[model samples]
Target chain A: MKVTKKTKVIRSPKRGFYDKETIYKILDNHFICQIAFVYEGYPVIIPTIYGRDNNNLYIHGATVSRMLLELEKGVPLSINITQTDGIVLARSAFHHSLNYQSVTIFGEATLVTSENERYKALKIISDQIIPFRWEEVRLPSKKELKATKILKIPIVEASAKIRKEPPSDEKEDYNLSIWAGEIPITSTIQNPISDPKLKEGIPIPESVKKLMKKE
Target chain B: MKVTKKTKVIRSPKRGFYDKETIYKILDNHFICQIAFVYEGYPVIIPTIYGRDNNNLYIHGATVSRMLLELEKGVPLSINITQTDGIVLARSAFHHSLNYQSVTIFGEATLVTSENERYKALKIISDQIIPFRWEEVRLPSKKELKATKILKIPIVEASAKIRKEPPSDEKEDYNLSIWAGEIPITSTIQNPISDPKLKEGIPIPESVKKLMKKE
Candidate 1:
């Protein structure tokens, strides 16, 4: 999809691109996102977990979710996901910036009503956080399903802004006697703590063991 | 400062805190934030870096920043900062969630015009990314300072929402044959990668060296 005026990057047009492939890559790499919507005439930003399946993005919460209630009114919403790759330290304070990849997805969200679809949407969300963990876990009960709400927003319009290179200092500032470089940053999964109320003989799942090794 | 109705955490009131100390700790620990505003009648979210100084929060960008321009007009804005602490893997998909700490501040913003204040704000912003790097880097030139816009938003109405516990699955599901626990997550400062065009003999600063050892 082309970059719509609504989704265009105005501050740094040179850093913007509207390719869905690039957008998906960034979205798949990050599971948490912030959603923007109007609440009582005030713009509000809320942090929540998300899952991307093909062209649609899913976010779930309790049926009493204020975000779900406000968003399902057919109002416009913007979802933002960002990952910091490195810290770019410039020779001048004015030129310091972060090397990051971010995606802004725009769409109107609709509530998923069908029981089958809600289960699928949540399974996608569960697996998004930890691959194959859903298979080992018990499924939701009927009352639990009734209390959960899943909303789907199609990727109708989206754009990505990326900055991967080192800082670009002035020609003269480069000669200054200062250390300038990027301190690489990445998120890692740390040690897992077993639940205090665990049953008698439940071992950590294989899925979690794999994440430990990978991390 | 007390959290007003504007910043109330309605969804999970038990996890909400309005105390300034808790809010400031969350803000100081995380540097990146997402700002929410209305553009062309549609809600928009943009990710940006921020700094916290006492009871005020600061964000800077190019003078041409649409977010800064719109915010300077005294429009309503929502600034959100979040840190993912762990992942709550529940025995049932419906109860799966993340352990995170997030703060949301709501207020009108004003542009910082004085040179002294702008320099201070940028210095605070720079230090927020990496301590002591600003002192080593050259100060911003007159033109560089002129091209940048810094906005200050008071922490008048703010709240921190946090969840750092293990999964709370259904009572019956706890006895089921599934793994349930908390997988920790944290951001570690990696080794600094010297800029390819760095001068010959600029040793890594003590600031970066400390971070390397600590991480």
Candidate 2:
């Protein structure tokens, strides 16, 4: 929403906005985020799983992870989440692009310290992938809870950019006979493959099965 | 790949790496990159389409773009491309992860100078999505070509880290009988939908059709 000296900071420049609904929709659709920050004066981008509860995003990492550890110390960071839906082929190569919905959140992460809040944040993170999985699985132990670091980033300044329609070409180039359109792309999750060492008689939970039917 | 204390930084201690093959594979599978840079002391992250040729990556923007114009002036920047393949669920919620490939290329970008190299880079950028379409479509005209700026960043001091398999949980936790495995995910291109303004007889070229059959 705020334009600085950087413009590429705005993806889908022709169609970009900071609407709350648009930002939430993009965030809910994607679960993975690439968090970028400066490490030792050089840039480092880390891919990690994140869950949003209310306006706060909870990202978890190992207790000793340099990224999470540094984040706990309160450094400014930029997190990006993108979901590609298709390939857009325009008549001109310059106009070619991707049909995608992405959200970029820039904020400083505050470490979650309260025991109760951290526990609920972890549950939210787990339920993000499958809502019912939280109850189906055993809760985390106190020691395990103490070992994990979950950081919360408030979604204050965020934006979404998307391209959904077909290609746009000059009228003169329309008759050139070049193919132009969109190749619909989708991210599909296959049936959950149980681990080889899984215990017998553990029926396939509905939480896990629901993902297979997602389009 | 050299892991400079400044440029090639590792964030995820548990998963980060500076491997050459991993970096190339991550870069090869993706074309769009989210370039992050500090503009006027504030963070800005923008997503844009990009192409890689040899050691340099070519990214273009409008001639009047403030961000791209600043980039052409050798502004410090961080470019990242990530392709998420699947979600990894573990017996323990803390251990949940994602199966993904990403590349973070950091350095000052130099504006491409030679006209021939710019044209060729444009073609490489075009061929990235569809190989045959570059030659099939009309090339950029002199005026259009001159109006765009292409910045190239050498592929140096880059690293890629991946988590591909099922989660590695404690031996005792595995015996707790929770469903744990990878939910395989894939980005597949479906049938192409032609633009409404296209000529009636324009057949879908093989280059466009090839995406649907890609594995």
Candidate 3:
């Protein structure tokens, strides 16, 4: 990953990471991302699902979606994926902070035009959400595929910013008789709730079972 | 909560909401937000913590932070807050989706100048993270307050988009022998870990105790 002027972590340079391994590790942990693009000379942001392959990130939307339409024009795109790990409590409010891992990517996205590549991108996206479920579910038909538009953004310029340690307070402030600690935050998958219209005899599949076990 | 052209939910119009009660309910649940601003004709996004009052949202950073500096110039700012409730599983890959609640605010922010208002905004932000924490910890001093910059954006042209129901698949696809359900996702606060350098006799504060009980 090339750390261009835009991708460099100007503030708190110590927390910035410009390697592909760190960037991909953070991106692979979360499926949802907030994408920012220029529309009508104003910046617009939208939250959507994304999947990252080797060097490219894929996002899909309906053919008539405004975000996809604007992004397909090869406009500059900024994608952010963040995960809040914990809340850092300090003896002083000025020193409080959060332990989070975030990656920001600055690049342009082009519409995926090839049929074979589109299918591959869609599969990568599905696998990001739930692995091994694509083989169990009914694949998208030609008409369905045509209704969806997929865009690929190369991860050429990106950087990850992370803070994982405890709170750092001023030297004398720590002596104050104030309670200070860390509250860990976690997002876990609960038990699956079956669909109301599900068939009576169908059991939970292996993919979900594996997810439950892993979580 | 006016539905201007910029705030209108173009795609999936049925999921769009234009009410204060609904939008605030979602905003009050999360403390992190993604903010987008145009820089040198390109959109840049940064993830930061935010707090919301009745009709305004407040975000703070170092006085010299790039995001705060750029936003204080009275440029257009876009803020997005999203919470993923669950993953909607369907019998077909085309119908898979996520149950999420998201709000997008389009407005401009001004640097909060008044000392009292700045203190109030900092208290609100600290409350958003942990209730009653502002009273327990050492309040920001005058010099510390001067080092921080707070910006407030009115929630006038904001809209919330939500999807909370089960998967809606094709009529014929539901009959297939495939598992379909919702995997609920939850962000919970675990037990608090005491600071390594904490005072020997200081017990956990009421704020953290209450947060643990509530969560």
Question: Model 2, range A1-215, lDDT digits (tens) per residue?
Answer: 55433323443367776677778888888777778776555456666778889888999876877888888877878888877788888777767777888887878899898988888888888877667777766677777787888899987667777767788776788777777888887777777777667788777777778766655
Docking class of 1: high
Tens digits of per-residue lDDT, candidate 3, A1-215, equal 77789999988899999998999999999899999998998889999898889999999989999899999999999999889999999999999999999999999999999999999999999999989989999999989999999999999889999998888999999899998889999999999999999999999999899889988
Candidate number of the best DockQ: 3
Q: Choose 2 or 3, whichever is better by lDDT.
A: 3
Where in model 1 is the C-alpha error above 4 Å? none
The C-alpha stretches of model 3 lying farther than 4 A from their native spots are none
- Model 1 Cα lDDT, one tens digit per residue, B154-199: 8877899999888998777877878889999989778889999999
TM-score of each: 0.97, 0.92, 0.99
User: What's the DockQ for every one of the candidates?
Assistant: 0.86, 0.57, 0.91
Error of 3 at B176 (Å): 0.6
i-RMSD values for every candidate model = 1.0, 2.1, 0.7
Candidate of highest TM-score:
3
RMSD of each: 1.3, 2.6, 0.8
List candidate 2 stretches off by more than 4 Å.
Answer: A1-14, B6-19
Flag clash pairs in model 3: none
User: What is the per-residue lDDT of model 2 for residues B1-215, given as tens digits with 9 covering 90 to 100?
Assistant: 78766444445545667776677767767777888776555555667778878777888877777668778878677777777767777777666777777677778788898998898888887776667778667678787887888888887766665667777777788888688777778777677888888878889887776655665
